[model samples]
Target: MTNLDFLLPKSSPTDLRSIVWPRPMTVLVTAPHPDDFDAIGVTLKYLKNQGHDIHALVAETGSGIDKVYGAGMTQEEKRQLRVREQTGSLRFFGLPDQNFRFLNLNNAPDDQVVDDEANRLFLEKLIRQIHPDLLFMPHGNDSNRAHRDMANMMKAIASKVEWPIALLFNSDVKTIGMKKDFYVGFDEADAQWKAQLLRYHDSQHQRNLRDRKYGFDDRVLMLNRKTATELGIREPYAASFEIDIL
Candidate 1:
């Protein structure tokens, strides 16, 4: 019933090659934090290579991350650091800075997303303006609170919108579980490139190292490798996603 409906059965999760959308599409990727976008780099790269118009909407400044790791930094400084890292990562992938945007959404612990009218209206307006055929975001069942909130917010907004849109929910470091309805398989070279993309957020990388005994890059790739092996993908790594139409 949607413009993207054609992608349904044609795009199966078992495919080993890159995704081939029926036509060029406008894609909006929602990131709860700066580095979340890079968590699914290979898939986005494939979409970009297929001539799709891709834009990133970062929902948060990731100041909370700094609040934990940055002992003496000002809030503004923390926000700027994350923005710079995200911008540099996008540049590395050949995306123009103009395509990136910061929603600057508030993260008050007491404000539930469904009850936040302002955020709902803001997101509704932004989605209507972009009018994207596909939306990419982290899966809702993630361990990170921000990631879960953003995913639920997007789903809520999508349900009420007039036009139909495809949602590609991705896996992250904290993703509990998801159905792999689509995927992009990559080799060692591509895996290394993705790692570099994650490495751009050095602050997060160091935090991950100190807390998890590995860097942020490895944390992501470990999941990628496991996903590939679990799905019987021939590639050395794979970025899997669960797709839905709304």
Candidate 2:
């Protein structure tokens, strides 16, 4: 029930980060979780090898890694451990420590990321600073609402950005299902390195199966086989992304 509802535009607005991003050559990969970049681990490494400046931004985090990753350990201990793990993984990717910006917003209790003023401000300030030539964010068609919100926010912020940026979706995504559009290749060492990255969330994987209803390590097999298949290979590990070049 509305008056002139059709008069409005289809999309919303966001301020985005500052204008200091790389000189249109650098890339920013935004992840919802700490190790999410692992989903696209090999692909990212390939990009890095290709001489692209890569940046990472995590959207939210728990106080400790344990509670954050369905871990059985104490929240305090898990938090410290996850930080150390992600830190190490970040270093392995050759990304500068300062580039891993954590938004630290809460999830689980209430998963919806409402596009309000605060989020807008935070995103705007970030965009103003990063000024990325391209941003790899969540896919709009993602099944997860939180993932969808990330894409929505990016689209809204598109107006404030002057540079033409692109967005790439990760393989860990379930909402959009197996994407068939894009694939990046990597060596066996690259696959090994990606698995090492996923190993950082020690607390998340060791959730005593006896006591928990469903507990097991998060395997990158699916990530690898799927992505490898896309590239006409049979590798045990790989990472993929769905691209939206705009």
> What are the RMSD figures for all models against the true structure?
2.4, 9.1
Clashes within 3 Å, all models in order: 0, 16
Q: What do the candidate models score in CA lDDT, each in turn?
A: 0.81, 0.59
Instruction: Tell me the spans in candidate 1 whose CA falls farther than 4 Å from its real position.
Output: 10-12, 16-20, 63-69, 109-115
The per-residue C-alpha lDDT of model 1 at residue 18 equals 39
Q: Whole-model lDDT, candidate 1? A: 0.81
lDDT of 2 by residue, 1-246 (tens): 222122122331111211122333577877765666766766667667666678887755543233435447654454456566677778877788887776655444453355566776788678768876567766667676667777777777755666555665665636566454445555667656666776655554454233353322235545466656656644544455554454
Give the least accurate 10-residue stretch of model 1, judged by summed lDDT. 106-115
Provide the lDDT at 64 for model 2. 28
Candidate whose lDDT is highest: 1
